[model samples]
Target: MAKLVQFDRLGGPEVLTLRDVEVRAPGAGEVRIRVDAIGLNRAEIMYREGSYFDRPVFPSMLGYEAAGVVEAVGEGVDGLAEGDPVAVVPAFLQSAYGTYGDHVVVPAAAVVPRPAGIGPVPAAAVWMAYITAYGPLVEAGQVRPGDHVLITAASSSVGLAAIQTARHIGAIPIATTRGAAKRQRLLDAGAAHVIVTDDEDLPARVKEITGGAGVRLAFDPVAGPGVEAIAQGIAPGGTLVVYGALDPRPTPLPNAHSYPALTSRTYTLFEITKDPERLRRAVAFVNAGLASGSFTPVVDRTFDLGDIVEAHRYMQAGDQVGKIVVTVTHDAASD
Candidate 1:
């Protein structure tokens, strides 16, 4: 039997229930894995609250990423075998079949061979955080050498990854947080400049850092009163990428009647995973970076699978510096 986290009707984290399920053999082009660790994303919270882009299906799984070992491979599945370590990209079925389970059965194409040096815990933490950051900073934003990049909500896992990715691409990173407590942490995470938005003017600090030219790229997750503020920090013709909605309020765009035009976009990892080739490339890029030590998964906390309710409670507090993970025991290796 496989233990999985699921919910029938959702209101709060308390609605999640852990139940045992039978593990069936994989069908053609599918694979079965003994899950080791699962990555938790803010999207899950929105899904639970009935506010995400996708509506939840009752009795659905609630995880987005996981790392495990292949326990079985179905016919016609190439390049994979039992006992191989792997990381899953759960881009499809964003509303169902999440990673919070003891075992997962997914299409073979969605599985990526994980680096041997990276353990299940850290590997599970990589996909969503890095992909969200990589797509905006490298793919969409096109951050170039010497370009200034501004990141809002700089203390999050995706935000931290954006900072590091920007530095790797030789761009100058300016980060914004709610207060001064996270300033040192952001700096250590490779931010060249940090601003406490409440105390310092975000646009002013960004202009000062960029010699009044403004940043070439702005990545924002918090969208509400500061939407225009984020745009003001970006240079004319710069890209402003919005990926997550941490704030419940609607993000207001600059009134065309008053403000100059800027390229604004809302991006999601779903777009990158729409094609199998793109998904493969993204997974390869992330794994390569992980093996080379250019990318690191910042684990904020890990909860036992049974304590997921507490995990959600802690995540809602909004103090975590990076990814929150759930640890689970595999059926084959019960200790």
Candidate 2:
């Protein structure tokens, strides 16, 4: 039997419950992993709250990131063996294969070897955040050295990853947060500049920071009326990649009334992860960054598997500065 989290009704974090169930062995092209850590994401919360892009089925399991050791591999699986340390990427739909469990069977393509020295907790936090950021900044936006990039909601795991990723490429990352509490932390986390949205005007401040030139690239997850402000701060020919819907309201595009020629597009991490060539390039790039010490996963807090409810509450509070991870334990020990 394996322990996993599931919820029949949607509404809040309280809906999540831990239960024991039989975990079937991996089938063809599948890999079963003894999950040691699970990463928390906003998408999970949105899914639980009935606000996600995909509607949930009753008694649904929802998760996308985890790190563990491979326990078995099915037919056609190659390059992986029992006892190998691996991390699951957020390549598939959460409804299809959730990772919030002690053991899970996932498509082999979603599994990647965990880099040496990156333990389960950090490993669980890596792919989703970095890849989400990478899709917009490096792959699509083509951010380059010295390019000024604006990152909104800059304290979330993905936002912080954008900061690190921009720094790795020699780009200037200007981070934005809802309040002043996270300003220093965002700066400490490598943001070239921090903007506290509550006090300052986003468009005005960004324009001032860029000497009226505006940023070369703007990465935003929150869309709504606020997106127009972000669009106003982007340079002509610059790109604003919207990857999420933190703001539930309808997002407004740049109006024709004296607006700059800013290009805006909706992007999802799947755009890169779903394509074989793009996924290969993304994985190789991230691996190189990790090997060279240019990229590091930041963990805000960790909770034991039993404390998942409290962890979700904390995430909903929106005060976290980085990734929240849940650790799992087994009675038997292995080398």
Candidate 3:
């Protein structure tokens, strides 16, 4: 048997329960992984709270990303073997193959070979955050040299990824958070400028940062009544790509009288599934960045599988500077 996380009903972090489950062998086209680490994401929290795009069935499994060694490979699987290190991508349905367990079975296609020199914690942390940021900034926005990109929720793993990605492409990344505490952290994380939203006027600061022309793109995850303020900061013909809803309030439409002819768009990583070429490009870009040390996965804290509820609570507290990870132990001898 292996330990796993599950929830019988929708609610908060308290709903998550750790339980022992039987380990089943992988079937056709599936691989069984002995999970070493799991990446905690806000998507899982939303799914647990019944606010995600997909609703959970009763007693549902809930996770998307993990890193581990392959224990076994099913029939017709190729290029993978037992004892190989791999990372599970967020491409599968959570209801079908959740990774918050000591042992998980997922489609072979969803497994990527762990990059060289990266530990299990970083392997679990890289895919979701980087890929989510990559789709909007690199693919859709086509961010170019000298572009000014605004990143909201600058302390999130995805937000940090955007900062690094923009810098990698020779663009100026402006990071925004709710207070001054994360200001220096964002600057150290590769942001050209940091905006404290609670104390600063967003549009005015953005205009000053760009010398009155305004930013070329705004990557926002917190879409609420303040969206119009973000819209006002965009340069004419610039785009605002929103990928999450951290705010509970409804997203208000941009003011019609606003200048700059801004375009508002919604993006999700799911689009990569429909376009294999884009996924290929994104993976190549991220892998290159990882190998060169241009992109680093920042893990704020790690918890044992037994402390998952506490991990969730910490994630919900909104104080973490980066990703939160949960390490799994299959045997008492392992740390």
TM-score on alpha carbons, each prediction: 0.95, 0.97, 0.96
What would the per-residue lDDT of candidate 1 be over residues 1-335, giving only the tens digit for each residue? Answer: 78888888868889988898888899998888888898888888888888887888887877778899999999999999999999887566756457788887887877888887898889888888888887888767778999998989988989988888887788888888998999998998889999999899888888888989988888988777678888887787788888878777878876655445678889888877767776776777777777777888899999999999899988888899989988886454551
Per-residue lDDT of model 2, residues 1-335, tens digit only: 88889999888999999988788999999999999999999999999998888778867888999999999999999999999999999888877789998989998989999988889999999999999989889988889998999999999999989999999999999999988988999999999899999999999999999999999999999988888889888998898888889888998877667568878899888887778789889888888888898889999999998888998999999889999999998767421
Which ten residues in a row are the worst by lDDT in model 3?
A: 270-279
| Position 233, candidate 3: lDDT | 92
Order of all candidates by lDDT, from best down to worst? 2, 3, 1
Off-target runs (Cα >4 Å) in candidate 2 are 333-335
Q: What is the C-alpha lDDT of each candidate?
A: 0.84, 0.91, 0.90
Clashing pairs in 3: none
Q: Candidate 1: lDDT over CA atoms?
A: 0.84
From the highest TM-score down, the ranking of the candidates is 2, 3, 1
Query: Candidate 1: where are CA atoms >4 Å away?
Result: 255-260, 331-335
